[model samples]
Target chain A: MAPKLPPHHSLQHSSTTATAGGQVHDDHDHHPQPRGIMRWLLTTNHKEIGSLYLIFSLIMFFIGGIFALVVRAELFQPGLNLINPEFFNQMTTMHGLIMVFAAVMPAFTGLANWMIPLQIGAPDMALPRLNNFSFWLLPVAFTLLLSTLLMPGGGPNFGWTFYAPLSTTYAPPSTTFFILSLHIAGVSSILGAINIVATILNMRAPGMRMMDMPLFVWTWLITAFLLIAVMPVLAGVITMMLMDINFGTSFFDAAGGGDPVLFQHLFWFFGHPEVYIMILPAFGIVSAIIPTFARKRLFGYASMVYATASIAVLSFLVWAHHMFVVGLPLAATLFFMYTTMLIAVPTGVKVFNWITTLFRGSITFEVPMLFALAFVVLFTIGGFSGLMLAIAPADFQYHDTYFVVAHFHYVLVPGAVFSIMAAVYYWLPKWTGHYPSEILGKWHFWLSVIGVNLTFFPMHFSGLAGMPRRIPDYALQFADFNLVSSLGAFLFGFSQLIFVWVIIKCVRGGVKAPAKAWDGAEDLEWSVPSPAPLHTFETPPDFKPVQH
Target chain B: MMNPVQRTVFRSVLVLIAMFAFAFALVPLYDVFCRITGVNGKVDERAQTLVSEEVDESRYVTVQFITRSGSGLPWILDVEQRQVRVHPGQPTEINFAFTNQSGSALSGRAVPSVSPSQASRYLRKVNCFCFDEQRLEAGERVEMPLVFQLTRDLPKDVNTVTMVYTLYPVAEEKAQLQAQVAPGSGGDA
Candidate 1:
């Protein structure tokens, strides 16, 4: 007979008796963990793999941050003293590539590896070995890209977007290496996405219908779908560039019956939605944090889900918003403008849902919530800037300048990076069964917030006053703003070190945590034991649906 | 309940089908999308300027071709390179021929852009397909040829409009691939 109770231990097997020592054997089997170095390579455990990815991402984050510090260091007093202009361009490009692909992205991926299955009541990822492959490919891809910096002609100077002709015949000798690296990264993304989608779709508990799933699952599911949808487009664009460089194709050359403008269309097609891929997960993290800190069931779960899907659909139409300054036909321009404006509707829904979730609820300002609140404020600032950029004619001026730089940094730093930090604080208890050092986390949060604003805010004025982006050096008029931004960059860079410190202290051991770490935590993740083991939700969880 | 290993296999097979179905639907959906959004490659035409007239004044001539385009990504326009024998230091006009075979009407202007890779700026235009877009409305046919001169600004030898252009398609498979792949690429946590 299929024992119908939701897969828990037999009452006799679950006896409260302890073994000879203090260890409990009612549930866990002592699978001798392979000793030492061999463990990471051969291990298929999701948590182990997640820690590996997280540590690797942090190291890359600092490496990428050092590059940002270099860019800032150059702009500190203006006459280009620390490095040559050419090298400076390389720094900016490398910084962007490393942060997006290496730091922010992997952080989220690591979190997903650790939580998604636990959150949704699955035993393992839909694909385990492929998980190992995806994580392994990252190091290889990054190594190739970093190696190109040492190449004869120097690494890619065309910026992370790598627009062509600039990336083509006019490119550095290492452009080929950059292209190959991106290709590998794309492969990794596709495989990883396939695994996520499968796991979510098929592995939920019998009663955990889609709506019953946590917001994190929903957001990641959407994120995975978007990845499957767009990573290929980026690959295609890079492939065309590769061909144009080696073979003679006019995909970007107008005189050869090709248009360079087409390259922008293709890149932004993948690029614009890409920015969303980075942020939507942040929204999910904040959603979880706010409810827990506020002690409330999320006020409008369905609305949040609808809002995310709407934002995704709208993401495709609004891609051309990035190309507004590139000069398209007038009608095409108008269409993109309207499509871009429509996104605000769904975005408004998300913001409203979050506020409602917080309203009237008992609110606590934990470190995660502190980061989440800052995200709301700063991310809103980024959004408002985005709205301003959406206006067609205004974008002509803002297209390739410091204002755009300010806009993205605001979104990415306080927006995406803050969320990642928030996630670490929020979930560390669940993972380590201990609260991180509250004091250290606060220091990290404050320094990051102040540092980020100082770094990015002044760029708006310099951009308005006519300083272009992606340039190594700037005219004297733009000096002071650059100085403030650079100082902010250093502060922001060092602030992240505190995150490393806090996480280490928490993981090593701190205040003990109970099963439901937070009083208001309602997700299935909390139903399992904290310090969620090598495997969990080994059967499935049972929970009553939160009635509307 | 199945053992952890067995449950994983059962779950994996189920999830794979669901994901494949989801990805499979995207192609037809995306195509339907292109048709609807008119994100389609478009066309606009403009009246041409008779930018050229053979001058009888300076007997010295140079022959060159110049290329220009409505799009930014380079396009592969079929340029027929022919040896147009001209006198040294003579300002001579050479006609360069090009065909736009792409589904979208190709728009481009050519200047003998390749040389000492210099003097290209003054390599003026006569007639260009890029005078406006040639809307090859689907199977619509159009010829985008160019006319330019190798200016006597030649130091004894510059003579060809190796107008190298790189063409970019409106969309590529890689972008489509990335779109499909990125979300699932991360860890299971």
Candidate 2:
């Protein structure tokens, strides 16, 4: 058999029969319908799918955000203002489960689905049915999971982590559905990853080398590979839980010759890579935005690729860092510690490169640039907190506390989520054929920045002061920080409504956009017509060949 | 030619795939490894008998349990603790059964999760099945087993070490959970 293409490289696929023709053909089969919902379900069109992903994620984002708001409302001034402890537990768990799995992740995957083929010049996803299958699985999985809230026992009150004993013997009746839903989600993720890998490897515009591809495509390529490698492990692990609950196995039981701690080991193994799965695409998006807005060629593109790859590899080896408080062996601890710390190097490389990319360049603070700038300041802060947690001894204090919570939220919220917002702001014009209202966009941006920091920043203090995670009620001393966080959460949740308004206004038609939305934007995506063609790049675009 | 990033991506995928395939083939391969080392938990078939008729002054059979992997999750191998006295050439049957009580899936084939350096050759009714790759939903319970023969040809010196079938939860279970949870905790949505 021919060697399978490398999952992360090999863009610029050689198309077989039909081409989208000159003017950058869309990499899809079906002709696009500029009209109805049928354009989404029956259409194999990449742009349509991408739009659907974005729209679906937005709805889920708001739904998940509502859950966050309720969480905040309850904790606003302490003493359960809006919900009981059980309801709070359900809210927090479902809030998190939905946002990450249903909202943010799907949004990014949508961006990738739409953009990857467009940028790389593919006809359509190599496996179209699989793509549909992946997206369809989301509703089924989340429906089962969200439906659990109305169940007799209430949804999984356990944290999203759902550790053993907590999810098993001690869990409510809904745990079974949660596990099965997760199994389906895992299957979806794996299928999505495989499709991405196939598309990236097999499809690309002529004369575009792997190194020559835009950073967004490059980062997603690695992220996709990470997804494929770990999702199956997730399926395998969940299967064990299924057996332990219904059948009779001692995998986690010491008395029956099983170890409970073993669950964590397996969990983190997939857990660590999963964090990158969320962020790596964001990395790609930020990379694209910064360069375009700053009016400069990306600095050290090759090094950026290496840094991303290194981050992915380091992710797998350092998983034990999360369990430092669980008592890993001294040698194992040391190894994980060093490995975790080393990630800082590659991560630092990315930060420095972004900063350098902006230096001495004609930088304008467009809506996209505004979010990009915020990402730099905030993501670095998140990274610093991460370094602090990497200290095994210090983690003993930070583990499961609000401090740890603050650190990750800083990374994920401002870091990953912020980048996503920026990408949408940047690409909205390309997809809609009109510019979103800058005034509303600015309102959305500033409110979100303030709201995000306000919501999560206080978590660090309360955590440092010893407020553990996952408990519904807390001591009076932690009341002040919780109040601030809750207020910030509501503000942040409301702020997003403006973004939806801006996007809707743009799509309905304001001022028609030009082929290249931004003056400084340099990419295959910009070479196409506004509101990009349905089946783009049926034929590859002409471009200068890479010198190297 | 692909650069280092591409090469690393390619190589790592192969390595991971190979690991998966290796994990899939764990039951038989692990058993073979154990048997080769005399750690297959099977007493020698042709070796001189430990329970000799001449030495009927109180014959005994002992089992041992040790854990080299999967720290602190409560894994054990239970043997019927009854002392049975039998005449020479009489065959006795003992069953080693596995029970998983943890909420997550436990991988049966992890290097050190199951065997304490004893009989590495463990057999199930099925081979290369997803049994070892267990995915336990909440409230899940399943049993695994090791069926063995204590032949009349067993060596006499091996009498007291308890036979322990260790348990190990696959690494991905908790890792995935933590990943899911951390994002949920920090997520804006």
Off by over 4 Å in 1: A1-33, B1-189
Query: Which numbered prediction scores highest in lDDT against the true structure?
Result: 1
Model 1 chain A: weakest 10-residue lDDT segment is A13-22
What lDDT does candidate 2 reach at residue B151?
38
Instruction: Tell me the lDDT of model 2 at B48.
Output: 33
Position A416, candidate 1: lDDT:
92
DockQ for model 2? 0.04
Best model per TM-score = 1
- Cα lDDT for residue B37, candidate 2: 58
Q: Write the per-residue lDDT of candidate 1 for residues A194-213, one digit (tens) a residue.
A: 67776777777668789988
Per-residue lDDT tens digits for candidate 2, residues A1-548, read: 11222233233322222223222332333454334555355555566667777888888888888887877787777565667898888888888888878888888889988888777766566567668778878888988988999999899887777677677766788888999999888777776777777677766766778888888889988998888777766666667777777775655554343446666767777788988998899888888899888998888889899999999999999988989976554667789989999999999999999999999999998899999899989989999989989999899999999888898888888888888889988888778778878889999999999999999989989999999987777889998899889889888989988988998898888877787899888888777777776655555666565432
C-alpha DockQ of every model: 0.04, 0.04
Model 1 per-residue lDDT at A334: 88
TM-score of chain A of 1: 0.94
